[model samples]
Target: MGFNEDRKRYLAGLEDKTYFMLGDEACAYGAIFAGCDFFAGYPITPASEVAERLAEELPKAGGLCIQMEDELASMAAIVGASWTGGRSMTATSGPGFSLMQENIGYAIMTETPCVLVDVQRSGPSTGQATKPAQGDMMQARWGTHGDHNIIALSPNSAQECFDMMQECFNLADTYRTPVILLMDGEIGHIRESVTMPALSSIKPAARKMAKPGEDVFGGEELVPGITHYGMGQNVHVTGSTHKANGMRDVTTPHVHEALVKRIYNKIDDNREKIIRVEKDISQNGQSKIGVIAYGATARPSLGAVRAARDDGKNIDFMRLITIWPFARKQVAEFAKNLDMILVPEMNLGQISREIERFVNCKVVSVPKIGGVPHTVEEIYDAITEVAS
Candidate 1:
């Protein structure tokens, strides 16, 4: 059978049961089920719970969990673990996310498969240690220097927090790159009922393995297979510009261009498969207004859209499940048939500006910061103003 059918059967075989849990705890569960055999992370607010729960659970599952000295070491540790053929990950907040940028770039250059969970909080240096914010939206895409592509998913509720973590790991393995679960503090700490699949029935996806003598770094394929350490493959992985065989070729412009383009195109070329969005758009040509949101802002946006519809208003609503590679085509298609698109985010129009790139309609950004999520009434008011 084909890969897609096999994946569907594996998922359908999982036994699911509901549990009331924190978003952070659910992430821990998702990682374990996704066959994460190594976790190395340092404790940080809003994200500490992920490490804490993994510390308690991983060992029982015969997995290793390490509380690293800092975010840099934490990131480096996971990269090393993945080279040993382990599905590895780390969890951290904004400051820690920043500290890992260099290594994150290294992971991309090396084509490592791993997951990074960023439970975002108010930032620009510890704005509020305890509260949540969606300020890290853009940073997840461009925090690391140079031209590259990343896959980031944002969860609006605790349930999504659990569900998306597995998808993150799968995408990482499939693409052979680091994937980020861009969770905000609100959803990370929020308690909700999550349906978790039984561990015994879980079957996670695996990355392609390079056979001996095969080029593990690059080849005719867009994403080359990877070889673990001690695999009898003469693999030379480096951050410098390299050829298809993974040898350093720092002085050749075409070599650098070819390698970088392949890395970027691996994600860009597969945007249709990578991007995901949830839409409740009006189809009767009655709505001229649409609301687009992600993360914490999505919760209230949905509520407001429903309330507005109850009040006889024609408004469409969409929630972005996949945050990076920018969902360019999906947003553009969502913008069609609308005169105005309202974007409510916890940051100052981070994603709205991206939407403006793809559509002809007037884009309105309802930005909120200082650790507060947009309320349903406020979003409803915005919809009403646009409709009037």
Candidate 2:
């Protein structure tokens, strides 16, 4: 489901086809297809290909792509670019994702819509250069050091690298909040076939705008995503607590509450619309066992589900495309219906913890660390043991 004539114009040379590409390259093309006019990122392995591809393609697309000296500046630049009416993104690995933290906070503070791609490699500090780790799952939600809510999407394959980026921008535009596309080195480096987006299905949302002059922003430009952009619009944009028109007012408490509450409200208000979960079909909800997974783990989960079904358990699967604002509604449904809930991820039960918090049922977490994704057998046994 994807594009049209307008979409066709944006990707005139692109079409539905199968091609093998690194996740980073697919991400770059994804950003382009999502109408990204600017890209800023620092080089970090597993994610460097995103920056590299953008460097070559952005200028050609009449978009601006920059390699900021560090991750901090890279994030800041994306925010600034968004204010000027450009959809922007930044890509990095764990270390750079850490550096982008405070500014990510600032993006939250300002209600700026942008994308951050974290191609996770093994690391607390530069741990594995080429290996994959879903270690940043929790970090994506809580790393910035605050009580703020954000959206994070993880992709399992190169195809998702292309598709999730589109979803990332769509979430950002609709909610006017920062959206993170989380991937690990395994998914980011693995090449796979991705079908082209449907031309008619891709309708892009422009930043709701106000004119440059003539009172472009009024009550509509307030904290919630009422106003997008208008040329000559003297909208007061700042990280400080802002008024309806977007001016800074740090000394006042009401403005702070209004601003902060709006950030949370925008996403909270749109939670149902934003949450995305993919479930593999397993006949009439009679699934004997279910494996709940996201990111790269879902890849193996697929195999595990098939194996279980073949072994007579009639297992099914639930995969997540959107992680943050974690698809609790769907997970709850699955938790209730399935005989068992098994969440397998590369990290130590970050998402499984979230799943437990929502549904009134038991959750079994099968976690893996040391930078490697679980094998199909690992997930299969974890589910069957519990189901048995």
Candidate 3:
């Protein structure tokens, strides 16, 4: 079926209502609310709830939900579904996320729009299947080889999980690329109150279609519209470097370079619109210590900032809502005036490395692993250590 028909069939089931929900459950509903009609995922801890919820709910809403053989197939399936002009998604944690890497890269090369949720767990290889960790932060940005840009968002609460998933779909549709919703086991299992916005308030983006005479992949727009597989537009979808007409041109260096550059530029050039960060700088504007965090780690980091302020420490916080594309420009701008930046995460200094790259100032990494999140006291201690 065509995109509109698929959307029309499934979109009617999403209703405006509030509920106390888990982060994983909230994400599933958000995807449904954002018009996801195809879900292909393999169950894995902390993230399995997402797949479970979709399995029961999607069918009730006239959508398709498949339990793939593995993460690789899950990722591949969503990309295939998306080409048929329907919103598609998949969810998995660390090991499964690793398995999905190659297909994720293919999604990037093909410029297919889909959403992948990585509800992170501690792992190099299944270190803690049921535990929360932010070790996947660096992997999320670089897991799929080659120089490519991707949009990733981190949600610290259940409400943000619901909210960001909608943003993920809109971003994917808007840019014609995969968007990652980076969550962790802690938030995924945690129950919290979430206020559902009215249906009128949630405006999901429609898939952009190529004009009758336009090439499926032709246009100067960083993100050009695409014609679906059976849409009667000459569609040539391949992972190799391709011409704007969507035909493979592997032998030409210019064709390869141009194709790759356009993919990166579509995201990098529009970074400002895609990036979202919550800032809590002191009113005096004299804070010397800055804390940068994302995902579940941001929860305690925010508390630490508040605790430090109560103790009269000059500390500020920047919680990343958008994790990928690195938030480079904003980090650089924030780092320039700070004495030190503390990166508190569940992993051993993954994102801290990125912060260090952009700042000449002392960059302190408060790394914690093995399933336990950093306590507010731990983050506050790091802030004091940096200030001293």
| Structural similarity to truth (TM-score) of each candidate | 0.95, 0.90, 0.95
Residue range 51-76, candidate 2, lDDT tens digits: 99999887776788888889999999
Residue by residue across 1-388, what tens digits does model 3's lDDT show?
Answer: 2224444455444455668999999999888777788999999998999999999887766689999999999999999999998889999999999999999999999999999999999898988888899888888899999999989999999998888888999999999999999999999999998776665676778878888768666578888888787777767788888899888899999888888998999999999988987898887989878999988889899999999899888787898888887888888888778888999999999889988888888888899999989999998888877777
lDDT of 3: 0.88
Let me know the TM-score candidate 2 reaches against the reference structure: 0.90
Poorest 10 consecutive residues of model 1 by lDDT? 1-10
The C-alpha lDDT values of all candidates are 0.88, 0.80, 0.88
Off by over 4 Å in 2: 1-10, 198-201, 211-230, 284-288
Off by over 4 Å in 3: 1-16
- Pitting candidate 1 against candidate 2, the one with the higher lDDT is 1
Best by lDDT: 1
Candidates ranked, most accurate by TM-score first: 3, 1, 2
lDDT of 2: 0.80
lDDT of 1 at 4: 39
Q: How many residue pairs clash in each candidate?
A: 0, 18, 0
